[model samples]
Target: MNDIRVDIDPALLTHHVERLGELGELPGGGMARLQYDSSWAEAQDLVATWMREAGLRVRRDAVGNVFGRLPGTDDSRTILTGSHIDTVPEGGKYDGALGVLAGLAALRALAARDERPQISLEVVSLCEEESSRFQANFFGSRAMLGLVGQEEPRTLKDADGVTMAEAMVAVGLDPAAVATAKRDDVAAFVELHIEQGKVLESAGVDVGVVEVITGLIWEQVVVTGRQDHAGGTPMDDRLDAVQAAAEITAEITRHVAGADGAGRVTFGRWDVRPGWPSIVPGEVVLSMDLRHTDPADLRKRATEAREIAAAVAARRGVEVTFERLKDETPTRMDPWLRQALADAAAVCGATSMGLPSGAGHDSQLMGEHVPAAMLFVPSVEGRSHCKEEFTRPEDCVRGATVLATALHRLAY
Candidate 1:
């Protein structure tokens, strides 16, 4: 290991984060820079400028994944760091932004010393991870690994009916050149992000070295029942889709509660046809988001939940269907990388623990093709995907220092 001290300026990280936040400021006091949007374009430009200022070579791929390279003594392979920059709707400042900023800070700190690593260091602002605009997650990572299917650009659409291809072109990125985004030289990847859950904060831990990213099973459940006039039909005579959906939702929640150990189920979105007070709903479409660290448990829970939904629909005299939207298997972080992170945390005198990430990340996708690890800073109250999400600057600085130390060990 190199006898190097990891030093990062907290004010610099804060300044870069605040500047990125200005690009997509929401009235609700957070950010909303969805993929390929105008705000996303501007934010990418700002990051490009910062990378150039830091004496790194700045470049963007076809899908708009930005890379700032600090060349090393031997550039045979590169050590990749950073995270996605696109924000969720009403997302906090630190979620994805902090990872990118921290990567820059670490690289800049090394550059200031006129030091070069054995392997090149590249800080990436990945293009999409939240899927806020289109149903595309890990767009930038997939492009880097050549994992994106050819049909994806035409099939996915945003709320405004914009195809991903159109959005890419609108941002002056070539859609046809997506294949050029794949890289053969990334030796390893490390991402730093907010914990996005209350576990670290509740436990008073300064950092979390992730063991695994949870597997996710997203499904759309549709309950079909007969519509009846609210006034004319007796309660016993009506077969209500909304009631069946409610019962199934409650049952799913109960099942998840019984599973124990970081299992989660959310029925966040719903759509009811003929949404009028006078008419009973004939159809209800609700989304199910189930996650767990164990792949078998995740699949079992999904199957059981679907069966329960069926039983609930049968009891309510309704027909139900479960349409799976996306199913992602659990991914384990590299053990060596985890150890390096733990050692770095120890060096920084920061408390660290092994925790599973409850949320999805591009790291999971990147893990499919390369060795990937994630570092976590505390999220106050474990809240995320909302404006109320926050992580203290002290925690942020600690996380970044740990990241810097680990990157130094890997690259230098």
Candidate 2:
């Protein structure tokens, strides 16, 4: 039984969070620190400085994944912690920032006590996870795991037509050396993040021990039909792509609702070609985002979704094509690490419940190479990726303490 007490300073956490927020402050009280941007550069430098101030050895990988290392009695294996630092456009101040700040505070608390563990501890401020720029989510995590594809740098593009390669260089990183970023010394991983949903808050729980990360399926649907003059075509005679698309979208939503958590389906983005009041739409392209915690259920839902689309297209006399944009399997947390977090939460006098993460995270990628677990704090109103997102200071402090205690137990 280890007797390490966490000495986290609330003021230090708040100060660092405020200072980091200043780098990418938007006009409307939000943050916009996209990857490889100038604001991201400044924020990275600031966090690196804090890591140094905490008496840790700090360094960056080839893809700009910053790490702070606290050496232990034996440095052969390491316990890794922390989260991403990038923010979505018009995103809130506390999404990824909280996790990184908490890691810093926890490490600093342990250092103040002059405690050493059996294994080294590291805090990583992962470079890219939001995909706000290149549609390359988990870029830093994937690079660290050697999961990045060779074509990613040349193919992915931002709204400004900037390639990932270009963005990397703009931030003083080399695209060719991405493979060198993979590390095999990590023994375990823990990430502390906001719930980003109202579950924990509504349940009156102080912390959430994540059990699984939901799997996702993204599809691009295209429906083709004959275009005709609105006045010249009768209601029954016209083969309308827009009409077919609308029917398919409605059916998809309805099926998801009836699936009993089989999965979630969303038709969030749509584009209808040749917008004109007098002309019928000839083509419709839309994006479908679906997710499920159960792999079998996810497969069933995806199959049903495609079948529904095909049925609708056939009945409406339109040609439909479904192209998969992204597909990711669900990831389960390490059982031993989960128990460690549960024990730490009890020690901190915080009630915790096991929950599933509805949103994707870098932890999903890290889990591929190392044993990983995550801690989640409640989000106010279950809101995230928006300007209105917030987490109470007390909740933040409690979560950080739990993280510190857990890390201490694991390393010591």
Candidate 3:
């Protein structure tokens, strides 16, 4: 393996991570940098300030996706890198933040080069990816690709009941200008992110070269049963919604538990009506997420889940209805770009192997329009979306260095 050094500042990157973590930091731990919220605005502004400090031309698109551009000799095409700025509520600092900061460091290092690249390089801090505020998936990337529906901004609301359009206006952005963010010149996209899984750490690898992002099926199940007083109704006589919902959840879990490694399922949200000690709930809502790398297998799992839900509801004396909140097809990284990432890792003296991403990323959506690839640094213990999520500083710099190496080959 050829040892190549790319100028990446470990201390600065770690410092930036600490600083950004403080923006939406909670009382106990983790961050809450939701999209279009004040914390998100503060975080984006801070990143913009840093971009300016790096001497790049900084601009915020209509949807609030911040871009720092280093123009190339041939400005017609651009090479894109970076990740989302938003996070899940009380999410770990490294999940999305590392990708954005790594891109910034990579671009800054590349800017100091003596020769210019053939294509421009841009680091994007996407406005939303976690969907913490609205149900709109990949808002920033969708906007960039002109895939957002016209009515989304005016229609979607947050927990505060404020429309997305209002939130945009609050941040001094015009929702009407969203169409203007559609980009056609981005030739390639390379995002640097934490693995958020145990693959790299367990295998004693430094970086993960993502091959495919899993397909997902999101189903919201609402179960209805007879409500009865806990004290008045006997256990055998009660047709409780909670019991039915619980049984349904358990059975669904059982269905996927013994299955092969090709599929996985999780029920994250459970809302019980009349949430009181004495009430036997009449309604229950559950959020089900089914994922797999193969499209056919993913669909089969989804169908099997539906059948299981129906069977469970029938047996439990409950009426169940399902609503699909989101359905995403599997996304593959560009083959050549994937090879470049692997070669870059070897050049950077970091061990890396191609792996499938269990969690979805902006790269999954970005792949639709541009040649997209991703580099993953290890998440300590594979913990993510929580305060315990972390990556060693040295590994962080190593991932960024690899990204820089890849960018040098792609752009320069």
Q: Global lDDT for candidate 2? A: 0.90
Write model 1 residue lDDT over 1-412, tens digit each, in one string. 6546688888988888778888888986878999999999999999999999988999998889999998889888998999998998888888888999999998988877766788999999999988889988688898899988876887889988889989988999888788889999998999999989888988888899999999998898889999889999999998999998999999989989998867899998999988999999999989999999999999899999989988888788899999998889999999999999998888888889999999988889888778999999999888888888888888888889999989988888
- What order do you get sorting by TM-score, best first? 3, 1, 2
The local lDDT score (0 to 100) that residue 349 gets in candidate 1 is 84
Give the alpha-carbon lDDT of every model: 0.90, 0.90, 0.90
Q: 301-367 in candidate 3: lDDT tens per residue?
A: 8888889888988887789998999999999999999998999988888899999999999999999
Candidate 3: regions farther than 4 A off: 1-4
Alpha-carbon deviation at 82 in model 2, angstroms: 0.9
